[model samples]
Target: MKYLLLSIFLCTLLACTPGSATKYPYTIRDFPDSLRTDLRKIVNYGFIGSPSYESAGNIRMQISDNDCKRLALSEHPILRSLALDILCNRHHLDHYSIMMQHLDDTAYVNWYYQCASFTFITVSDFMVKEYKWYTEEEKNRTVEKIIRDHNYLQSAYEALHKTTLTEAHYPFVRKMAEKETLMKFRSEALLHLAGYKKISDTGFLHNALYQSRHELDANAFGIMELYQDPFYFAMLKKYFPGGYYRNFCKKDFERNTTENALSYVSALASYRSEESAAILEKILFQDPLVPCFPADTFRLRQHLYEVIEKNTCEHYSKMLRVVKPWLERERKESAENGFPIDTTSFYQFPSDSTNPPKIRW
Candidate 1:
């Protein structure tokens, strides 16, 4: 018993040693103590309501220029991202040069937004697109290089968006749209071309949609929304059929499911046909209502009403028939729950029915 206790004591002591079982297990031996402290905070960042949650400013303040440069080279993608962010915050002339060092880093970083996060964005492609450090001339030259090399095509694709694309860029963008394996990159290229009204032939669009059978991503959906093609109405209906809608409205189907469902709804609203209206009517008025939280329910309704109101389809009035009574029921429910619904700012309900109330809060 005495020997066993001693062995257990030694194990715990070894476990508690400085480098052993560290929260950041990756070796950060090169950074100085103060910088290491800051890096530690950065390494553990993005947890909701945790002390590790760091804003950009807070991160920038602690990391020196020297420290940031070193951090930019970190094998750890998150730390490397921190270095890029700090450099971006500096707004220095040389920030772009330092950023170019890791422009090819395909290391995936999980980016957090409130409680939700996208797990797929690489450290290289995302943040650089957002910064405004490049000149119009510089942007053009860099985009040309990115396209010519094909090594940095993802960054090139993103840079294309910020610059005023010329005739020179269209072929490259279209080619990237054709060849890139990533759905987002392909869709993004298509979306960019569509934005410029350059997609006279939608063969590329159709092929891309066919490949994206798993889930029509946001950029692909953006194209459908832009063209408002009658053909995609049938496709959208097929993609978001009755079973999908039933699964989507449940409380458990929060997060990205909500966004995906809403995208389909918006696409449906784009069409002016009775078929489009019927799908929406079923969504808003049919059984198994959006059983998300009250706030989430409000959000879905707000989006539905705004889109329905803007649409000029013949079924608009038919679709809105339940609006007044629904609003009244919501008001009654709110009052009963001690959070009364205020004046409605969302839908201007048809005045034909005894002065319909608006919903704001």
Candidate 2:
């Protein structure tokens, strides 16, 4: 009961400007009673299609240290999430103390992720809802600006990475980095911040590559990519035998257009290590998984090989011993019979999955 009341008070309290008694635009009550009822319904359903995104006016109320502490203690996921966003927004050195504690809580993992999921759905989702008020013409007409303005997910990450994590928070971030699951972008954002501040735990990162549990498909890989610290040659094998490649590649690779595969290759080539060359060579000879189109992949292999050849000459000798004969044979075969037309356009491959699926369409 206390938890419920606290939740209600906090939810309501979120509307107020922090450190000031003044409510800048208007309280939820300022809306017409009918509109307010409709707004509550939209909030309840967990969608943000209603006029509320605009109506809310990007209200970011401050969370006082007392309230920040209270929020950290709440068992409720929603409040826990709110606490995270508030701390990120506050950017004070003091908030680090509580955030570090949450980072260590095993149960708090999902709660932090849920909070990270965005305290609000982005305009991208809103455009899909196509509220009559927002989308009379095609959303394409104005969505670019709208999206840039309303990306809460980006805001959450920026707020987090931009804040300084003092020695108080360093131990905690390191602890979370050791085993935190499925927190890709923000995890890297924080990791990069840690790197900037020199709060490193390279040993933990090296060990984490071998552990497989994940929250999202890209979590571990993304952070590993971010560190490029004491760069691991084993990240090359993740392209082949790494736990992430097997588990998430099947489910998520088709979506990444095998850039996930390329990611491993890119990181591997970056190391220029013998092990990196060997792993790429091992995978190079193998057939691709079901979702992978062989024709496109043939080019991808060519691209990766070139990367390795350029980056690591010492190891390239072994690769050349085998690859030179294979390329000659392929050329001979092409001359004997016309080359199989390249169905996969290397030009068409996405550099990254930055263009998220369209919500407005």
TM-score of 2: 0.43
Tell me the deviation in Å of residue 117 in model 1: 5.8
Using all chains and alpha carbons, the TM-scores for the candidates as numbered come to: 0.57, 0.43
> Once superposed on the true structure, which residue ranges of model 1 sit more than 4 Å away at CA?
1-93, 107-123, 126-163, 179-186, 196-200, 242-257, 291-295, 323-361
Candidate 1 lDDT over residue span 40-144, tens digit each: 665667321224455444556776787677667775777767667668657544765765555666767766645454445667665555455435555555566
Q: TM-score: which candidate is best?
A: 1
- Tens digits of per-residue lDDT, candidate 2, 144-262, equal 32223332333233333434445554544454454443455445434544464463455555555554333323435555555565544444453456542443344443343444555
Query: What lDDT is reached at residue 335 by model 1?
Result: 82
